[model samples]
Target: MNRLRTLLFSILFYGLSVPIVLSVPVSALFGRAAVVRHAHVWALMHRMLYRRVMGIRVRVEGVVPPGTYFFAAKHQAMFETLELQLLLGGPAMVIKRELSKLPFWGWAAMQYGGIVADREASAGALRSMMREAKALKAEGRSILIYPEGTRVSPGEQPPLQSGFAGLYRALGMPVIPVALDTGIVWPKQGAKRPGVVTIRLGEVIPAGLPREHIEARVHAAINTLDRG
Candidate 1:
């Protein structure tokens, strides 16, 4: 049964992931680039398991923009969190502060160039996030954020989280909105279905737009694949 397959896949995937996550410290010893490169391997491993075990395939459409740009994607399942990073050639992520402090995974993510955002939105936290974002950009890396803050079911579309707009204004990178129907295949709390999860990149929205304008544009763009 599919439940048996999902259970087996989860066991294999997470159990196997420990070694690579543990190896992050060794990579970090080499430097940031080393750590980022090491992360690619981890992401690849997860993708392979998703395909080989769960029969899930990711189909990405539309050209990834040429240079530095902020990417906002609809959060439907856990798939896109790391998949998009791999798809974008390891761009820095904007993760929540708590997640950025986990253990080896958190440490590795930070070393791999993630900006840790504080959900409470203190002035200091925002400033820290801005500094990290600028550092990533300075290194020619873009940022990938799930603007709705948390994953929603496939048919639901939540408004963009405030942090996304703030970061967009701070970084001023052109936005590339990505839409994915990941929940159809990987639900929040249910059996995993085997199917193609589509990630579509919508038209670019230029930087420096008014907050209201950019927010609306992003809200519409990242939900393009949602039938609702």
Candidate 2:
């Protein structure tokens, strides 16, 4: 049954994640890049588990651009969080500051060079996020951000949060809008179904566009992957 498969996969996935998460501190000793490479391995392992245990397949469409760029993606389920690190070759993630305050995982994420945002801080958060993002950009790392700020169901489309536009303008990198229907198979907080999740990469939205234009374009591009 779907429920049985989801439960089994969750147990195995987290069971495997124990050693990977614990090894973060050891990886940090080598440097931030080392920690990032370890994170990529973690993500890859989870992807492999998903395929083997849950019968979920990931199919990517469109071109994934090269070089350091900003990635604006739809937030549907936790699956993409694990997939992006593998797909983007250890790109810097835009995550909540609270998540970075955890135990070992938080320490590793900090060393891995994530751009942490204080969601409740509004404008101040955007400023802080951009500052960190710029530093990561200089290191030639792509930035991955979920513009919706949180997971939404597969068919619902929401306007991007304010931080996305701010980062796009301040970072001055081409924005790669990505859309995926992971929620159709992996619901936010329930049993996952067996299916192929398609991730579609939209054409690069050139930098220097007006705020409204950028938001509109990304919003539409991401929703294009929705099933309904």
Candidate 3:
């Protein structure tokens, strides 16, 4: 019965996401106010979907800093992207190319200030991302990114990818390490399990740190949560 419910809800969730994303332009034409409202509305809907369909509750810790600092969070579940802004305000994400292929979601994500990347297009992608990140920072938007590049399985830990270190070095931005235990509840590719997921915010790793140091600190912070 649980499986049936989850499957049904999952189907509905993905089915609706497409149209929602594609309607961004139409939603914007209604006016700027409408677009802002739509983003907030969708954030709420995203929370509801995860709670109802995925059976996962989020427990956040520590205070989210003000202004634009890069958020280096652990990636372990599909819900990470959706629930990013739940408690943290003004936070937009750096997402991968696969998300952009989903018809409606891709559009909506773009509209709501997400930074999408085409991993295959290395040089071009980095240039574009750096430009956007700087511009968005000036506009007071926090940038959230999963430094690991891909979701880690429940029993496995993936090394933090180099892109994050490169971004920090290039952007010269402070980074907040967010530790989360999401795999237990929202497994990378499996049935959702009912559980409470805790996301703990660590100390700020200031900018200008050496590349090797930045990589090590970020990796340690994420691994701390994975073990806890």
Q: Write the per-residue lDDT of candidate 3 for residues 17-106, one digit (tens) a residue.
A: 656655678778885445546766666777787788767688888887776688898888767766767566647678787886676667
Give me the displacement of residue 139 in model 3, in angstroms: 1.8
Q: Which residue segments of model 3 deviate by more than 4 Å?
A: 15-19, 30-37, 52-54
* lDDT digits (tens) for residues 1-228 of candidate 1: 779879988998889889988888888889888988888887888898899989988888998867988988898877888788788778898888899889767887888998998988888988898899988999989888888887799788777778888889999899999999998889889799789999999898999999999999999988888964
How do the predictions measure up, each by TM-score?
Answer: 0.96, 0.96, 0.86
Clashing pairs in 3: 18-104, 21-104, 22-104
Stronger candidate by lDDT (2 vs 3): 2
Candidate 1 Cα deviation (angstroms), residue 94: 0.5
Whole-model lDDT values for every prediction:
0.87, 0.88, 0.75
Candidate 1 has a TM-score of: 0.96
Query: Pairs clashing in candidate 2?
Result: none
The TM-score of candidate 2 is: 0.96
State model 1's lDDT: 0.87
